[model samples]
Target: MAEDSGAEKTEQPTPKKLQDAAEKGQIARSKDLGTAFVLIGSAAALLVFGKMLAMAVLTIGQRMLRLDEKDIFETNSMFTAWGDAGGELIMPLIGIFSLILIAAFLGNTLLGGFNLSWQAAGPKASKMDPLKGLKRMFGLQALVELGKSFLKVAVVVGVAFFLLKLFFMDIMALSLMSEPNNIESALYFLGWLFLGLCASTSLIAIVDAPYQKWNHVRQLKMSLQEIKDEHKNSEGSPEIKARIRRTQMQMSMKRMMQQVPTADVIVTNPTHYAVALKYDQGKFRAPVVVAKGVDDIAMHIRKIANGHKIPVIESPALARSIYYTTKLDHPIPEQLFAAVAQVLAYVFQLRLYRKGKGSRPKNLAKELPIPDEFKH
Candidate 1:
C-alpha cells in the first residue's frame, strides 16, 4: 500500500503550488547588492574628495592667509601655521562631512527604499544559539569574506607598486631636464596618478560587483527542508485545509437547497447523490447543473425538489457519474448523453402522468446522436 501511494504522487508541481512557494520570501532581492555597491563607491568617492580638499586648503592658505612660504615650511612655524589654519579649515571640513553624510543617506535610501526598522538592531533569541555562532565562525560566508579581503589587498598593493614605478620613471625624466617647471610638473604627475588609480579601481569594481551579487544570492538560498516548511506555513497544515473543505461543502449544500426550487429536474442515486439541473432557451443551449450534493445534503435536495414541484428521478449510474465528472453550473459531459436524455424524458412525462393521461412516445432514443462539433 505504501509503494502504491508513493507511485501515485505527482512529480511535477502545479502552477498554484509554484506561486505559493515563491511568495514565501524575497529570494531575488536586488536591494542588498545595490546597497553594497553604494557603500564601496561612497568610500572611494570620499577618499578622492578628501585628497582634493586638502590640496585646495594648502593653495588657499598660501594665498589668502598671506603666510610666507618659508615660515609655512619651518618646523616650529609650520605647527603655528597649522594651528592658525584650523579656524579656516573648520567650515570646509564641516561641509565635506555634511556632503559625505548626505551621499551615504541617499545611497541607503535609494538602494533599500527607506526601510527604517529599529527592531533590526534589537537583541534576538536566535543570536544566543551556539550552533549559529559556530556556523558564523566557520561558514561559506566567512570564507567568501576572507577571499574578498585577500583579493582587495592584492589588487591595491599591485596597483600601488605599478604606480610607484611609473612615478619614478616620470621623476627620472624630470631630473634629466635642465629646468623643471615645479607646479606644472606636479600637476601633470598628479593627473597621471589619478588616471592610473581610476583604471585600477574600475577593474576592482567590475570584479567585486558580480561576486557580491552572487554571494548575496547564495546566502539567501532555501534548502529543500526550508522550502517544505515555508510551503506548510503559507498553505496551512493538512488539518486546517480539511476544515476549510468542510466549511466550503456546508456552504455549497445550503446554496444547493436554495437553487433546487428553481430547478426543472432532480437526478439522483436515490439516497446517495443528487444533481438539480435547469434549462431555458435564452440561458442555455442545453441543460445546466445548478446544484449537486451527496448523503444528508442529497436528502435535503430531494425534499426541496418535492416542495417546489420539480420532477425527481432515480438514475444511480448517471448521479454517480455526474457527481464525479461535472461541477455546479456546468453542462453535463458527452459520455452521459443517453443517461441525461432518459432523465429529461422522465421529467417531460411527469405532467401527463399527473393529469391521469397515458404515457407519451419517448422522444429520447437509447443511442442518442452526438453533435459533430461536440466530438472530442
Candidate 2:
C-alpha cells in the first residue's frame, strides 16, 4: 500500500543501507575541511621548521657566494656546489610536505571514516547521459555546493584584504630595516597572513562538515515500504517462516512416535498429557522419559503405544509431573522416584503374568507417593 501510494522517505537509513552506500563510495565529504587542514598544516609546518629552512637557505647562499676563482671557471666544481646546496635543503622540505599530506588525508577521512570502492572508480553509462548530467548540474545539492563556494571565496578574500590593510604599516617599516632584519620581519607578516587564511578556511569547514553529513543521511533516507522489503529479504517472509516451523515440528513428531514403540509403558493424564518411559537396571540408574506431549500429540502417542502393545497407565498426577518437569530422553525428577518405581514394578509383574510365568498380580494403588513439589 505504501509503495502504491508513493510513500515519502521519512525513515532513517538502516545500517545495511549505510554500509552499501559506503561500499559504493557515497559518503559525506567536505572539500572545505580538507582545504582547511592543508592550509592550517602548511602554516604550522612552516612555523615549526622555519629556523631549519632558513639555515638551509643561508647555507645555499653562502656556498654560492664563497665560490673561488678556480671553482667559477670549472663546470664540475659548480655542479658539485649546486648538488651540496640541494642536499642541504631536502630534509626540511620533505618534513613540511609530509605534514601537509597527512593533514589532507586525515581531513578527508575524519567525517566519512575512510572508504575505498572500485565500483565508484569504475565508469558508468549514466555518467555519460546528458539529461541526467543537466539534472545533477542544476540539482539542489549542486546549488548548495555553489553557495558554499561563493561564501568561502568571499570569506577568504575579505580576510586577505583585512590582513593586508592591518599589516600595511609593518610591511612598509620592513623595507627601512636592513638585510636579515627585513627577512625576519617579512616572515612574521607571512605567518600572520597564513594564520588569517587558515582561520577563514576553518570557518567554512565548521559549517560544511555537519551540512555534508546531514545531506548524506537525507540522500539515504528509506521509505516505509523499502524498510519492510529489506526486512523480508533479510529475515524471510512470515509465511515461509511459519512453514519452516511446521515442517520442523512434523519431523520432531515423527521421531517421537518412533521412540514410543521402545518404551516399557505409556503414562497418561487420560486425555490431556502423555509420557512414555523406559528403564534398564544395567544401562540406567533411573527410568527415563523417552517421549512426551500434550493434547493432540498426547493422543498420537497413545495410538502408537497401542499399536505396539505397550502398557498404557492412566496416572494423571504422574503424567503431568513428568511431562511438565522432565525433558525428552531425560530421567524423571529424583523427588518422583518412589512414584515411578511403583508404576515400573506393576508393569514388570503384569508382563510376567501375561506370559503365564507368574500368578496374576494384585491391583496397583490408586494414589501413588507424588511429592508436593512434583504435584502439577
Model 2 stretches with alpha carbons more than 4 Å out: 1-5, 68-87, 116-119, 173-184, 280-285, 348-363
Best by TM-score: 2
Candidate 1: minimum summed lDDT over ten consecutive residues — where? Answer: 24-33
Candidate 1 regions off by >4 Å?
Answer: 1-162, 165-169, 172-189, 197-228, 315-325, 333-376
TM-score, model 1 to reference = 0.48
State each model's CA lDDT, in order.
0.65, 0.90
Q: How accurate is candidate 1 locally (lDDT)?
A: 0.65
Give a tens-digit lDDT track for model 1, residues 1-376: 3334324322344444434433543222333344444544445444555455555566655745576768767778756666657766666566656655665565445522455344555677888999999999799777866776686677667877888886887766766554225444554666556545545545555565566546544544454455555678878999999999999978876776777898888878789899898877697867788988889889988988888888887766666777777788898876666567767767767667677785664543433344444332
